[model samples]
Target: MTHEDVWRAIERFATEHGMSCSGLAKCSGLDPTTFNKSKRWSKEGQPRWPSTNSISKILSSTGASIQDFTKFIEPHGTERQ
Candidate 1:
């Protein structure tokens, strides 16, 4: 999937798990702004993706598997896992 797709999944995962962007970052031991909207885009307007290490940390914090997160990347109205 595209970087934006992955980021959107991350956002959905956090919300589904009852955490705000900052809350997820804190729980994942990252800077509170790590997942903030401001970080989703670069100064050049290019998409900014989460690092694998950050993804792992967030997965651990939420107890969600990669498969579970991937479910969020399915079509906008599709069923969720």
Candidate 2:
């Protein structure tokens, strides 16, 4: 999946779990701004990647298995291009 697709999935997952970006970050033991959309953009206007540890904590906090998150990483109906 593309970076854009991954980001979209993350947003959707957070919504489905009834979480704001800051809420999710807090649940993951990260800084409140860690998952904020504003922080997604870097100084050069490029998207930054979420850290693996943060992702892991988020999944655990939401009671979602790693497999579920992985599926989001490569959702169906989205071409692999």
Candidate 3:
């Protein structure tokens, strides 16, 4: 998936759970700014992806499977894992 796709999924996942990105991050034991749009990029404008640890914490806290998270990833690219 693309960086945009993953971030979009995280946004959709948060909305699906009735939480903002900040709320999701906090609930998952991360800093509240972890998922902020600002945090999704670096000062040099490179894409900053969410960490696997961050994803794991969110899934664990929300009782969501990796499959569940994957569904939010748009199939707009040819990349596969």
Candidate with best TM-score = 3
Please provide, for model 2 over 1-81, each residue's C-alpha lDDT reduced to its tens digit, 9 standing for 90 to 100: 666666766776787688887887787788988877777779998878887888888898899987777666665476344
lDDT of 1 by residue, 1-81 (tens): 677677778888889889987898899999999988889899999988889999899889888898987788855545365
What lDDT score belongs to each candidate, Candidate 1 first?
A: 0.84, 0.76, 0.91
Task: Give the local distance difference test score of model 3.
Answer: 0.91
TM-score for predicted model 3 compared with the true structure: 0.90
lDDT of 2 at 13: 72
What tens digits encode model 3's per-residue C-alpha lDDT throughout 1-81?
689999989988998899999999999999999999998999999999999999999999899999999889985664344
Q: Listing every candidate in turn, what is its Cα RMSD in Å to the true structure after a full C-alpha superposition?
A: 2.5, 3.6, 4.0
Query: Which residue runs of candidate 1 sit more than 4 Å off their true CA positions?
Result: 75-81
Summing lDDT over every window of 10 consecutive residues in candidate 1, give the lowest-scoring window. 72-81
True-structure RMSD for candidate 3: 4.0
Per-candidate count of clashing residue pairs (backbone under 3 Å): 0, 0, 0
Candidate 3's error at 10, in angstroms?
A: 0.2
After superposition, the stretches of candidate 2 with alpha carbons farther than 4 Å from their true spots are: 74-81
As for lDDT, the candidate ahead, 1 or 2, is: 1
